[model samples]
Target: MRDRLRATLALVVVGLLAAACSTGGGDKGFTGTRLETPYQAADIALTDTSGLPFSLVEDTDKPLTLVFFGYTHCPDFCPLVLNNIAAGINMLDDDESAKVDVVLVTTDPTRDDEKAMRAYLDGYNKSFIGLTGDLDTVIEVGEPLHVYVNDGKKLPSGGYDLGGHSTFTLGLDDSAEAVALWNQETSAKEFAADIRTLLTDD
Candidate 1:
């Protein structure tokens, strides 16, 4: 399963590179990879940590939205990405911060209930929104974004390993169209700089 996930990720990376080239180097000023073709935000209706229906498009009031697909149980990737984003937001001015909304959609909903999701996200940023729902619903939400989500190999203890999921953090504009993506390796400084660029452009 790990091998298959790696292959899929490799293909995704190749595709992103090809798209970047074909698009004549999209939005060169941004630190993240600009999309060749923007993606309209998925019309998602998921339960937030507060047990309220959260509509990705309608609920977000910010001009810029950062959407990430991950689970709370992830040992390294999830925390790293969330923390960096949180730190990046902290670097912005109050007005700039208010223009951005960070959202996390759990890939493993079986264990990531509303309570658990809220607790996990609070450790990073209290303002960060976490969404969880039925596994099928979660998969459907990720499909249009090209963020793959799948269960991992089982362990001898009857538990499973970390789930397979895409690591890109998508950047969405006011129109709810995805404009860019950041990989797991992007630093907090890079995130802040790119966000500032977006805000200025807007």
Candidate 2:
């Protein structure tokens, strides 16, 4: 299965370059995982910070939809990834940057209530959208993307234990399909460049 997926992704990358070149240049590659076969957006929906229904489909108009799954209480990677995204957005031209949507979904939904989630993401960028709801919904939304979310154990203190989750960011194309992925090690500049390519590419 893994090998097949990789092979499919190789084809996806080639198609993207060929398709993108017709629109413009310098969009032939990216610093992230460019799949040969695009990932179809799943049918999962969750509650946004504003208590409204939220899904990647809602941001399909945007050239790119970046999704990350982690808990608000996460000690390191979560905040770092969000910060990288914010920095990446800053690297884009105003109009191109505006066309990107960053969505962070809570793996620990039980503890990451709307208020907490909003506050946490707001610290990174006011434009960031935070989503939280039942754990099952979160899992369903992340499953297709290979984002695992484990509800953490309880601790002696009122706080919960650290949770385990995938740390890669899934990048969705204009039609709301995931076509690329970037890990925590990816820099803001790299992400911004890839996003710009997606926007300008046909």
Q: Best candidate, TM-score-wise? A: 1
Cα lDDT listed for each candidate: 0.79, 0.73
For candidate 1, what is the TM-score?
0.85
Tens digits of per-residue lDDT for model 2 on 1-202? 7544644564455345434423233435677766656767776779889988887776456778898887788787788888899999988888887888898888777788889989998899888889888877877777766554532344343333323325678888877778877767778888888887767766
Per-residue lDDT of model 1, residues 11-119, tens digit only: 5664565366334645565668777688776777999999999877778767899999888887877899999999999999999999999999987777888999999
Runs in model 2 lying further than 4 Å from the true structure: 1-29, 150-165
- Model 1 misplacement above 4 A: 1-23, 26-29, 151-165
Candidate topping lDDT: 1
